[model samples]
Target: MRRRFSLLALFAIATLPLLVVLAQTSDAPTCEIVAPDLGSYIGDWCAIWIRVDDPQGPQTVENVTLTVTTSPPKSKSFVYTTSRYNDTFFYANLSLPYGRLELTATAVDDSGLQGSHTIWVIHPFPVPYFNSFDTPTIHFFESWGEDLTNWTISPAGTWHVNYSNYHSPPSCFYTGPFSGPITITLVSPPINLTNWTGEAFLSFWSKINQTPSFTIPPTDYCCVEVSTDGRTWYLLSPYIVGYWSWSFFGRYSLTKYVGRIIYLRFKLVASSSGGGAGWWLDDIIVGNEKKVLVLDKLVKHFSCDSLDEWTYSGDWSVCTSTYHSYPSCICCGSFSGNKRYTITSPRISIPSVNDGQDIYLRLWWKFLIDQDCRVVVQLYYDGLWHSIGEFRSSLKRWRSSSFWITQTSGKRIKIRFMVEGYSNYASFQGLWFDDVTILVFNRRIATKGNITGWFSTENSLWRVTPIRCYSYNFSLWWGDTSTCLCYYGVSYPLDLWVDLRDVDHAYIHFHAYWNFTDPQSCASLRVCYDESEWVLLDTFMGARSSWTTRQYRINGGCVVRIRFQVEVYSSYAIGFFVDDFAVLPTTSDTASPNVSIVEPKSGAWFNFTNVTCVWQGEDDVGVCEYEVRVDGSSVAVELPPTTTNY
Candidate 1:
């Protein structure tokens, strides 16, 4: 029996699924330049991160250094103190002058073998130029502030960059030691204050609460200092006597330093011991011109479940099988297709950039046609249809694409997506596009008010992204720039506060919209309440043609916080899109809103255009807006939130 069992076991083992495992070899680790891909027009700040990988494991690889070939082309090494992409990188920042630079990132494994990757970078702005800092590392200022070494402590900066309390929603220069008293210095690079009038000054936002330390009022204060030629320094005032609660927007004259280049720094004094959320400074403007950015989210949602707002000329049809959203998408020419098809959208009246607004054209689509075919997106206005974009390549997956409508903004234009293939026997099998929308973003700068929450982004692209943000960025350009270097994409992780103190149960519902080509891209929502450990509520992946509704329930808690995080990789199909977020006391409703006609009886006949209809509706919360449909065709939309007769 033992011999028979042994023979049977051998046969079972041979029939089991095959597994493959790789062991570490003596090969040297390789360096992946995760950022500033090849050639990037660098602004005032330049950040370089390199992913160092080895067969033994990226963590086992030792030191990584970056060298720039400038000024006689000698290699200068910089210390990379951080790792990213699941511990596949060692990265750092560099301050360089305006010109072309060839950067070499070299990594060495524990075995002492070396690997290197080099790329070119250009800093176009001339020094003494006042430009914004959009990168993670600033070249306009040489930071004496330290890198973030421990998550338990504040990050590097003499005036540490903190998010606890802010004049801005997310970050500001702050000083206060959470663990103990420590002095940090943040100094500016050369600021040529030459040729300045008496009005030329330096200014920052501060308050007494910035230095409300436990040790003493004045000891833990934030000191503003200045220097010329980077040597001797002098203190500037309102000389601190005591800390206050109100914010002081101070503007100090720089008339004395006008003849030469000067330096400025915020000093966090050593006596700033004990726990205070720390001193805060933000919106440090050197001149009088203030740049304010206020984001107003205006979304025009058009359901593709039916193509009433569209027209097709050829083989295009509404498909339901595979879509970014559910139920439908207008498509034509499937895999290996060769047919000409044209679809036109209703005239889109976009607010122009001159109106302090930008228009974003977002759509979800997939194409599997041949290279000989062409997909052209054209805008018809000003007497003729002008081409906005054209695609000749083959993309087979459902993808989200965004277009920053330039030149065409402010014009009422009709868009046409035309697919022309010379072949006779190709079909897209339909289901190529859905959820076409026009997003209008209006920015009002210099507006005073708090506009942020506990939202943070890890990538430099998200820090100052121009478009596609609801107070946060989903990508460098909400479109396909293909800057897939590091985990080089969008990672929007937001913390939403929910008070479930007295409630027994609550439901969280949100409309999730996404189209990610990379299998690694994903989104998650985690909940924490009543001082409990973080509990995962749910996670979502895969592509969708239409929006998906997800709801999770929390039984009980005091103050609750939900963290919604999204990490995208490989493609810029779309950014993290989760909307209609709500925390309700009950999971009573997940269906359509209830509506009742107060005046019109059921099945009553009335003239379509002459009759008046009075109706009232209530969604789970309350009525948002109402749309009236007659015979399944919308006659009126976005009616007043208040129920009324139409």
Candidate 2:
């Protein structure tokens, strides 16, 4: 009886249904459409979506045909079709001239099923090639001062830490590889003037003895030291010898433990080996340690469900049984035997709020079957989930998906996979995720209130004309150069007159309007900071079919004169128009008015101690007061019309 049962079990297993998957023999399918509602299709931008719905068969729906016609049977007719995607979307480019339009789709299939949808087309604006470099806002912090003397002098012209007597250059020196401790000190304030943290650097010139056996003691070469109270010191690290022509002058970095007044000290440890010799030191510098903000640090992971975070698996595409704790929902691997694949856990949570800026999402996935898969990522727009885009899986390889999340609002999002098997044995593996970043627009540095003077038109190319030839704050003359091509191949001729006070850097931004008169064309704008010599900052080419704003920065101060010359070398007619030329302050330059005594005050005076003096100050907006200085010193007492001071 046991042998008979075993035989029956084996037979049953062998009789199980054989699953078959077909290859995708066509391009990505078009959108499916729904029949028009009421008297006319209610919404414009209507679409017809389609996709292969059959399994164990050819996923390709060959020779698909679509016909769209208005209700009144007007001459206006538009037709388009999808070769594949059991569900494909189609729509008329410009809607029917009359009230309503009907759409029908038919494809060759064994099932012989037909699908149809009615849609209306509204005036569609050509999708802009979202340029992240639009309007160029730059967050360039101008270095306050240069390290004239290597003595790591900070912007305030002092060391980054506190120290002993620091007079001038010839005053600094180094002493012998001691029978005693060698002392090094500098006098100055902290590195970062504001709420700064972490370590800072202090540079000073030191001349070591050339004696071959001379070795600076390990303890003697300690990192520069810093202290808040001038006592209870802290050292950065042990010093290392730096290369030099005459002597070894090395710099060290020290952590700033104190703010405002800081003291720096370096002590030479007693060394018994490597030349018990001497050295000389001079020129000390102090500055804040450079800091960097990585793009990865600022990114926040998200899920459509109630989860706050996404899970990270040790292996790509393979998920653990457990979900992420911080971010509630995560991609869990649908495990079967040794097989593991990622799948969405239902009821996911969207984050409470988005980063509220332009962000990018990267997805890594693998399929374990011979099929084309799609991961539809939906964002909570308005009140429901709206599809932003989808991550698609190819025939044989694991594919990565990426898209920018431009929508700024709403929290929850939903992600689901659409799998169409060309063969039953489809699967993906070894998926990895990385390099996800959000780019914040930075263009202010190029277009802020740094204008000089003058405004003029440069030239006219491709219907672009600069009214004036002379260079000014708003415009400039770009030498005229012509191409034998008709109006279609006209170059971009643009002149800028920049008010030195109104703009500082020159950025070329313009839009080529595409209309019936002008079909397609390309042009470029060139700019140079010098009127006498021009350096081409950028040469914009490609479909000049839409408005585009571009910006570039050059190192200059006040009204740096520049020229913009346009050159077109295409035969295709293109229309070009440019405006919104702006030069704004790179950063928030709003500063508090500084009060200084400019008049009746020059130097320290002890002679006329009781003299009545008048003072004045200047500021960005306007001067508000006159201060009084007596004997090279300022007093809190207000100035009197005809008074005396003591």
Candidate 3:
């Protein structure tokens, strides 16, 4: 081979002169810590790799070396071998202790040109630990095997350990504001719950402070998440900072993952456009606790002679002697002017009841006022107070009153008593109440079928037609569908009826919406006890854009019929619409009246000539009439049918 120079010898000899000249004039070789960059958490045997490159040739590179300096004053060095031309690769299998390590790579060319790069790496311990950051000196590793003791702070300057903004004593971890788009997460060690039983809960306290402008788009969001494997996570709670306050996120039941190993992490994400005061967290806990639900019925009798279950606002007291029965009664009294005294009963619940069952409130009360004082009973229903009944005039002795709690079968309710005095001349004795009772019974009529008696004549000028959705802007009633008694393009009256044959003390309820263009346009709701005569129950005048509930209570009757009449004064007005029409039967009062002679004792003789007599009368529904008699001769004057006294 023409003096037989080997290939290796020929390559080295051909590049030797060129490599020496290039190394003297070229820049220093560049070095980069490609593997395990800054802020990386590694294990015991970490493979640290570095790449060194030179612009000259591979023969221009002299040596590549790696030096790892760890805490506790320990150091190690490794030399790398080049495997490719113009590029040198260096790697070391490092058994790093649980601490921070400073990795420096240096590359020196044959001409004495050198380049160096330095990075930081962390070796963290394994999990199942807690950290409060209370230690005086910040260390990369703790004597105990806790990963958070050697937690990696990314980019080196974003996180801080301080005593401010902590819920508990000592210190907490805080993330300061940064320049632009950043995501910081504080992760907890693995919590092994594989052998635990029952229910488990995770709870923590956190506070966030941010700019308090509503117009700005929210750029900061914080949440807690849990992971089974470290790669995937499920969010627990996500919140944006609306105000600066300390909030305790109490136990969130993690019963769904009772028997599995999990990890908890708090993540904070922020954007550069809007700045904030950052987030603070402390007192994190995970434990085994079960949550309970309450589902119990309410029952109160007031038989213990105590007002403990009631709340009163104004002049109220408990009296032991002057009551309906022996033990006690609630006494409200001595009111003047237009002053009112109110007492509210505790909240009571009625579980689901059958269709035809009835609920009643029974109580005994006595009032000593003359004319200007009244006692009104109200029931709280559907966020409003409805007056059930009232007691006026003088009742010198105890009387019983019963009210039907209709339309509230499966709800929670409260009963309120209001005593008001309109004048100063009323009696000072006030009102006395006792023996409050709530009872449920099956007293309603078993007939529960819909009335099949709606009549509309096509030849008539006024007819009932389905409401047109396009004409009224698609405004719907309670049932979203309705019928209107329309006399379109005319000014005539419309009539509609539904028959109720044997309904006893029934109520007719319907929803109505009307738009009257003219002032004289009106509608009248009526009921007929006899076929020829109609009794006006209610009348609607003027305009109503929204639906209004209308109800009428009819006395027990065999030939009852409900009718609606609408009259339009002008043709420009849109006719009325009615929906959800139903006849509901109420409980009938069958008990006789309770009468007592309170004044003028039975065997006592009268001394004066014009002795005014007083007596008490009460009934469940009402005391319709009262008749007075002396030795069965009807000597006393007759009182009105609505009178409760004589």
| Best lDDT among the predictions, by candidate number | 3
Off by over 4 Å in 3: 1-299, 423-428, 444-646
Minimum summed lDDT over a 10-residue window in model 2 is located at 137-146
Q: State the lDDT at 181 in candidate 3.
A: 66
Total clashing pairs for each candidate: 18, 131, 0
Estimate the lDDT of model 3.
Answer: 0.58
Model 2 regions more than 4 Å off: 1-222, 242-260, 274-283, 288-646
In model 1, which range of ten residues has the least summed lDDT? Answer: 135-144
lDDT of 2 by residue, 49-113 (tens): 44333332455334556676542211234567543433333233333321334455544544444
Task: State the displacement of the C-alpha of residue 577, model 3, in Å, after optimal TM-score superposition.
Answer: 58
Write candidate 3's Cα lDDT for 1-646 as tens digits: 6556687789899999999878566577888888887956676588877787887666566776777664321233334443323456767766664445567878888768888899976553221111111111101101111113324445555566656556544555667654346677876655656545546667566677554434444466677888888779898765555444656674566678767877776777666654567777654656542321111222445652777888998888888877665457988867556677899998888556565554667677776664467778888978988776655544455655656564567788899998887776644458788988776653311111111122223332332222322121122221111243444433233232323334457666555677776777766777766557878888777778666655556765444545566665564556566654545554676777787776677888877877766666765444434577766677434333224311
The alpha-carbon deviation from the true structure for residue 107 of candidate 1, after best TM-score superposition, in angstroms, is 50
**Which regions in candidate 1 have their CA more than 4 angstroms from the true location?**
1-299, 334-339, 352-356, 422-431, 442-452, 455-646
lDDT of each: 0.56, 0.35, 0.58
lDDT of 1 by residue, 545-576 (tens): 76555656676445566676667766565554
Model 2, backbone clash pairs (residues 3+ apart or across chains), number:
131
Ordering by TM-score = 1, 3, 2
RMSD to truth, every model: 32.5, 29.4, 33.6
